[model samples]
Target: MSLFKKTLIKKNYKYKLLDDGISKEDISKAKNVLNSKQITMASQTRKFEETFAKKMGVKHALMVNSGSSANLLAIFAAGNPLRKNKLKKGDEVIIPVLCWSTSLWPLVQFGLKPVFIDIDPNTLNVNEDDLIKKINSRTKCIFLVNVHGNSCDLFKIRKIAKKKKIILIEDNCESLGSKLKNKHLGTFGDFGTFSFFYSHQITSGEGGMIVCNNDNDYEILFALRSHGWLGGTRFYPRRLKSYNYYAKKYPSLDPRYIFVNSGFNLRPTDIQAAIGLNQFKRLNKLILNRKQNRKLIIETLKKDRRWENQFQFIEPSKNINPSWMGLPIIIAKKYKKQKMKFLSYLDAKGIETRPIISGAFTNQPATKLYNLNPTKRKFNSAQSVQELGFLIGLHQNKISKDNLNLIKDSFLNIEKI
Candidate 1:
């Protein structure tokens, strides 16, 4: 089959990976922003940022174009020359193997060395012991990923970071509504990022938010989100100093266009922010629905006649209250080779599926092009996930009986494979 022909003939599944991500209410909110004709980062965006910061218990939040941009901004801000304790070139940064490409790319883009750490397969997060062993005096930062709404012991990881004086940046994009113990997963580090993508806990079509507690970091993020322009929160007298001081010093230069630091234009539109804010109001409800749907699917599968422990499901990590993005299932070792065949059968039967976060990042072709893992070091745990794991969506709405039956039937097709 020709590539174009194949694309045209791709399976049309009855159950989609994500249902109508934007609701009527969400559209109404977005329409209001559109009708106002004030779409570019305005009052709506600022309001969303304030509400997000309050809910996440962070001092400040900056909305961005996408989760990838959020990651880029966080790492760039960390390495920016304007920061007092910024990372320099060739500094080592530790990250998990089971992470998204954007999580690792920013470190490489900034000339920082990335040290790969394996994940604990059970928790689907970084292996703390291995992470600790990889840390040395050269390590300047820890860009940890909270995988699939689960996290490693973030409290212990925070303590380790504190002891080592390393900057902690949590890629909490997949785990936004998740909590570790009583504290939220994203709030455990110097910088934490969240995604409001189509399949996340909340959806805004395409958007992301970065949060920080320190006033200086917040100011840096705000400026960086724009074109490095100086004035963001001029309401505060203290914040006006950068503009005032520079205006006085330069005399001729316009304070409005002062490019104080290196930056990127990663701002989210007001329409996206409006939709995200409306969805944010239903976040708790969405989280609960997904959790219940996951339980129902697991129970329904177990009750079926085909139930023979053909798959293993990932459980929430200790001291964590998860907000699942999907139902991650690992095929039995005996069925690993036939995984693709089973997945195809599921698709043919009108059930949709996806790989677990693009499997292990090191195994990707882009990693080789960038020479990310130069030593070709093996990540056994991560590799196992690549070989054995696949996921099906757990919707934010309760699973209907028809959909539940379809899921059970499709999953049980593994027996034939």
Candidate 2:
């Protein structure tokens, strides 16, 4: 009776957003950490921080419990009193309306006003012209999200921010190995944050890292990441000028227990660090496989006779070598109304899917509750993406022809849904 029944029964097709991302070596690394009984934030975390920093070409990299926590730390550190160029209350931060929730919340929670900008629908990233137009004297920071492994012209953005003396923090959670003109995406900012959560470029069950090039900023980040306690860094002990001064100044107080600044408990467990470090070693391979799979899937769909321009695939920005997490597809205007039903059909056939980063975060109920968008005005580009966009995973392993065929068949049959 159902149109999908025959295809479903004949092929027995099923696809997932990820294919066992954690390898045996990853599990063994975590297991060894667990067996050591020193499962807290200890040696493994320190080693991972060192290796991550060197690989990213940053002076320091601190591990955190999650990417959300990394964002929280970065925002709070930028506004910290000890920092030379700190953001103050009422400062305006320009952000894309098409970003993750945590990316925007940290700005608001830190007492900064957010000015929303529309995205470039083609690249699915912020439009440089619109972003620059929004900057004014009140603007103190630029909180940019590299949306789905793609970036706006960050080279130009960095130039503008430097001229205006505005702080730049990059949320590189969705893009781990992505590079622009050979330089990593996250390394271009005052602070660059990464996530190693399951289904990302790497998996540690849950983990994240933050990188900075400046010694002073790195020290402040190190202190802020772990309850504001200063002078415990193994990465660069030579740079902590206040370590001896504070120790000798306060003879009565325990020098080890010095609290130089305000902070939160965002340290990751050693097990997570071990797992993340192991997976991180193979990052190049993972990026390559995902890139290949993405190319294969797009080629498969376009080469199919059923292809009638029913959907549009987002391409990387110029000079960007992308490390894709998933294949983002936009339904053509004619198939827009059928989006939900088509997704449901894909699900029934055992194909998993998700909306494009929760669909125009500005339109969410929480945004209304907080009165984030006081104008209640809709962002045209973000709204278009919300209505027409969805993503399917491009796994770390090679996709079989059957899997590719299943995706092509299900996607082309939007009319049936």
Candidate 3:
């Protein structure tokens, strides 16, 4: 390595949320796309979407600019005019209190009322029972976030959703390679979303995918992902019957420019797709490395004499073989007051940390600004999570002895702080 590169690595050796997110091979794939001069959402994106769909065990996959855009497309498609069963204004969508902002915002943006259900403190996912209880006649959808690679009985939830005829969308952004009962986490819902953000399971710098099984849903998503045109650019061929129908119906309109539905420009570039596909080819290895690193960190801390139950690690839920996004740690109640100080100490020590999914979405000021919770009902479990939980990076490679020691020493200092 060059001196500058070596120095840069040395400077970040203490701890980082990500370590060289893109591999040399990933960059090479992106470079090839750039050299081809066809870097738009074309063949590379389609190829990645196809491989992703087959690997995910889904019928279709659509690439977008980011996971947020994936969620937005899923929401808008679920409520699209062409959809047989659609959500409308004032319809209720069930979501976990401990969720990412984008997971909740799309519902609100679609004019759907969000019914926030508390998460299980252990799994950091929606409590299956609480979620079921919150479902009512108005509950048209359930937007579940498989938090930090852990999920709450998705089979049970899927059954309930099917029985109630409710749309189920899984925000599996943080758990792309994870599985429950040998099936991928994202495949159990009507729609599943995944992210390829810098710190996620795989990195393409910034990209995401939405997947579904229904043919009509795939068509809806295809049109909505672009500018609602029946035919995409010459590079993106449309074989769907709807394109033909629209083309024949509007004889005067150019077949290449037939507009059929409301949409957004959420397409991912070929460069991002090339990088994402390259990373995805090694997803299983990445997942395994992260799992091993997590195990090593937890074992190191617990075996340490200084370990006095100062922290709690989130274990994967039953039947889940997780691909963790990060190592989520919940401080003991005694150190709850010192959590902020401990985080600051870690930061100063060159150990990075973040809140667990921004801590209960309802606690955010934006929720208050939108008057989402008029009743002021509290979610105590979510509140406790907000107070106690934080996350550290789980690198794509095995933890080094020095890095392991750094984490162990810095984390155990919680007691002293």
Best by TM-score: 3
Query: In model 2, which regions exceed 4 Å deviation?
Result: 1-13, 231-241
- Residue 5 alpha-carbon offset, candidate 3, angstroms: 26
lDDT of 3 by residue, 176-253 (tens): 999999999999988999988889999899999999999999999998988987776668644567877888888999
**Tens-digit lDDT track for model 2 on 1-417?**
363444445433378777778888888998898898888788889889899999988888989999998999899999989899999988999888998899999988988998888899998889777788888999899999888899988898999999989999999999999999988999988999998887888888899999988887877887887778865543322336677887888888777778788988898999999999998889999999999999999998899898899889999998999998788899999988878778778878778777887778889898988899998878898899999999998898899888998898988888778
The 10 consecutive residues of candidate 2 with the worst lDDT sum are 231-240
Error of 2 at 280 (Å): 0.8
Off by over 4 Å in 1: 1-12, 232-241
TM-scores, each model vs. reference? 0.95, 0.94, 0.96
Clash count (model 3, backbone only): 0
Better of 2 and 3 by TM-score: 3
Local distance difference test values of all predictions, in order: 0.85, 0.86, 0.89
RMSD of each: 2.4, 3.7, 4.1
lDDT of 1 by residue, 291-328 (tens): 99999999999999889998899999988899998888
| TM-score, structure 3 vs. true | 0.96
